[model samples]
Target: METKNNKVFLETIHRKLGFCSTTYVDPVGLSGGLALWWKIEVDIDIETSSKNIVHTIISDKSNSSVWAASFIYGSPNREGRDQVWDDLMGIGRTEILPWLCIGNFNEILSSEDKMGGNNPNPARFTSFHGMLSVCGLFDLGFKGPKFTWRNNRRDGDLIMERIDMAFANAKWRELHNQAMVFVDAAIGSDHNPLILNTSFPMQKVGKPFRFESFWTTKESCKSIIEEAWAVEYEGTKMVKVCKKLRGCKEKLKKKLELGFNPDYLVTEKIIKGKLEDLWQKDAMFWHQRSRIKWLQMGDKNSRFFHLSTIQRRQRNQIVKLKDDSDLWKTEANDIAVVYFVGNLVTWRTLAIIGIIPCMVQVVGVFFIPELVKIGKEKDLEATLQRLRGKDADVSQEAAEIRDYFEIVQQLPKARFLDMFQRKYAHSLTVALMVKSSFYKFVTFEVPKTLSFLNCHEHNLNQNKDLTAILVFSGIQLYVATAVGCRVRVTDSHANTLLPLDIKGSAGSLITFCNWASAWVVSYGYIFILDWNPAGTFFILAGICASTVVFVAKLVPETKGRTLEEIQASLTLFT
Candidate 1:
């Protein structure tokens, strides 16, 4: 439109785009021009025009609201910019309705809005900033590039500035709060086009599920699949296989949760202490999220992981670039996991590498059998390599594992009758009591007290009595933590249910015990709410004593005996 000598040539271009009406500010002999076009039935009336501005009044046609839009084309000359500023201010004074003033203003509001440009005159910024402040207009932040105008220059003397801008009054901004301006690609001109958007579609958070093929490494997978598929079912062969797959999924999930027992982790050795135990759970979660289902996983998982990330980056329009300086670095790409098999410890490391003396701060390190030394010189030369030397403790344990398992394999089979005997029964009873009470204290009182403080703040006594509430909460926390710490199972006490075992029986037992405790506490809360606190305590005390007596009469002992002997004795005695 800049070089089109007259409206005749411009009309041809305008007609091609299907514009019905156009309000034109003809170019000053190809030096400058402005064009504002509207689709048919737009309900916009052109109120005013100038060499650098096009003002219009717009109604929604729905009898909803009316607004004013002033399209600005600011002058590029250093001195002529002041004229543009005066024109905007004059128009701003007359805007009574919600106003949106936008277009290529040929100015920027801040220094950061320019790249590779001569330092902006501070007075120019003050002029624009002062205008906005005085008129109560806000710069509507854009969605695309920070700088709307690019130099597009390969020469050493290249520059870019955010000359184009959009500002709205408070009412206009509030009406379209998520409004955005996007920069379109340059077509036949140096300046890229600007697209204003009033509504954006919402994005979904999480993705769909897809199984991973990496879970086959765990031995539990084989047994779980076998057990699931072995069952007889009346169905089509495909349907039968799918039913078996569903069953296998459930079994594997339960197996994966084996080591996530919160109390067991805090009390007994955690999975992190045994990677063989932790590996299955990690595989389960990663497999569920990775969404790759190939038979032979190999390096395909990693490859697909990076490829999807790259595609996503493109979709999101994320720019990964540098401005000819290694001092400024981006350390977001690449991943390398170095594992030390001999010991149970984790170290997270992120080291950036690039040409021409780049630098990134590496965080955390682990001994890879031996030490992993990372050295960097003044010129940013560095080496990160794994070296090897086995620890004596690790070697000793590795040697003893076979002997330890062999002894365990020799032990006699365990049964339920073994749990019910004349001795050691009180220990199991106490375990249940302490576990129940700990959950009750933390789950019931802590939340209840906090709720009371928040929901009934005005009803409470203030100032002179505030210290009493604080002290009470503090004491409650201290006692709970103290008792909770003590409630962790002693190794001797854990052996009580050894015959019942961890895999086949413990999950159901623990779930039952927890649910039973919850029900008991729920029942107590009812009486405590309507009756005396004394009545509730008395009922709880009776339950505890009744439990002790029940254990004494029905349960058994396994103290100071090997598991095989204990199982044998209990089996014969019962």
Candidate 2:
């Protein structure tokens, strides 16, 4: 079953795994090795091989369709990884088939790609991004733990990253739109194995049989039930009742042949027509209830109609009402329904609370000066000087804002899609990275629900300490914002495309990411924490810590810099 020889070892594994063929590229100095085992039904043609990668053409025996795949084990050395990128670029140019590249590339596309460690070299990220762009490939997002590889360290020096991944081109995505990748648990190895399912798994569903109310209308139904009830059964009272009901259901089903109906169309039409009539009658009745009879009589302006309204009002008016238990009562009790029951506050009180705050804003708007961007030239200069301190010179900054608005007025209005243009790709990438990281960090820190708070309270063994968690989170967020402001301060339009629409779109993205992070973390807390709380918390803490490194390594500093200077710095990355 086992052998020291490489071929014999691989053959034994292939045989046990029910694979008909096996091949391997031997390891060099315990670093580089490659192996593949496949079933006899699959047809794979080896196109090229190297120490770093093996390229092959895979043919689906069932469909007679072919696709190319590159199995990579990239070199750890910098120069060697760069060579692998070059080789991929070359293959991307010549190969016309839909291609997929999957394995450990020994490189990361961004700081977000790794957890626990110093930020990776920016050059490596640039190279990886360039390679993917040249090849028109994108990550096929996975469903499992965020990271696929982790160091087997139990101490503070532990690290984990998604070094192993899968990428496919648009053609491959189109051909296999339903395909998905799953990360299996890593049993003895550091990296988890991936399972690529080309189609969704089949689910076996058992439908329970129920007795229908309509089945009673059949003439034979009563006889079927009577016969079932008359049969003798051996069980307790509850079990006997269940058996009788089940027997009656089965007899009725067999007698009626419920699976098929010859008169389905005729019966359906009659029922639908009756239902439509009922709906119309119900709608009309409600519509009549909403009408005001007094207003309708007044609108007619007729003596007879007006007299009838007055007579009805006089008859309905109460002179004295009898209380419950037939006692006479003079004082009227307020029995109106409370429409706004939130916190037991009525609608009138809620309206007053809302309107009272708006009075201050309505009055304060007149005293506030006009904005520099849209106000008259004189007002713009005065507002700018007041904001910048009267002693300071504000002519240039004022002119810049005014001139920018002037140019904006002359240009055609931008659409939402303008934010996604090629020229704005760098800005979009930065925006998404910052927003997602910010939300993920915040979502993890805050308790998503009461259960989450209870979990923390249970762990801390003090209900009062819950306040400390929230207080520290608030202080941390404030300090982080202050630090971020110190590092980057620029005009809004300098780093954004379609600035008017960015707020709405960014808000939507933030909300979606927040919800997604909450959902993921909830599952992680439920499933992962039950098994290993330390491991779960460690992964979350690593993610939170990595966000700080991501911002430091990726975001450009704009402190005390002009708009032109900021753009010049960002030019290097784009």
Model 2 residue pairs with clashes? none
The Cα local distance difference test for each model comes to: 0.54, 0.60
Q: Which segments of model 1 are wrong by more than 4 Å?
A: 1-5, 204-574
Position 500, candidate 1: lDDT:
38
Q: How far is candidate 2 from the true structure (C-alpha RMSD, Å)?
A: 32.6
Q: Model 2, range 415-510, lDDT digits (tens) per residue?
A: 546656665555555555554434443354433323344455553435446656664675466457545643552234334422333433433443
- As a whole number from 0 to 100, the lDDT of residue 450 in candidate 1 is 42
Candidate 1 lDDT, 1-574, residue by residue in tens: 2332466777877776567788787778767677777765467888888777788987765445688888888777756777777777887887788889888888888888888858887887788787777666877655556676766787867888887778888767656544566665566767767777654443333643334454565455677779887987779999888888888777766776673345654643544566544454454544444455563433333433433333233245322222121111222331111122113332111111111111111111111211211212211111121111332234343334334334434665434354345442443444344434434633454444443343344322233256457646644654565454444433343345434322112222333454455555544454353354334444444543454454455344555767676445443223
Error of 2 at 102 (Å): 0.9
lDDT of model 1 at residue 18? Answer: 63
| Sliding window of 10 residues with minimal summed lDDT for model 2 | 331-340
Q: What pairs collide in candidate 1?
A: 421-555, 421-556, 423-557
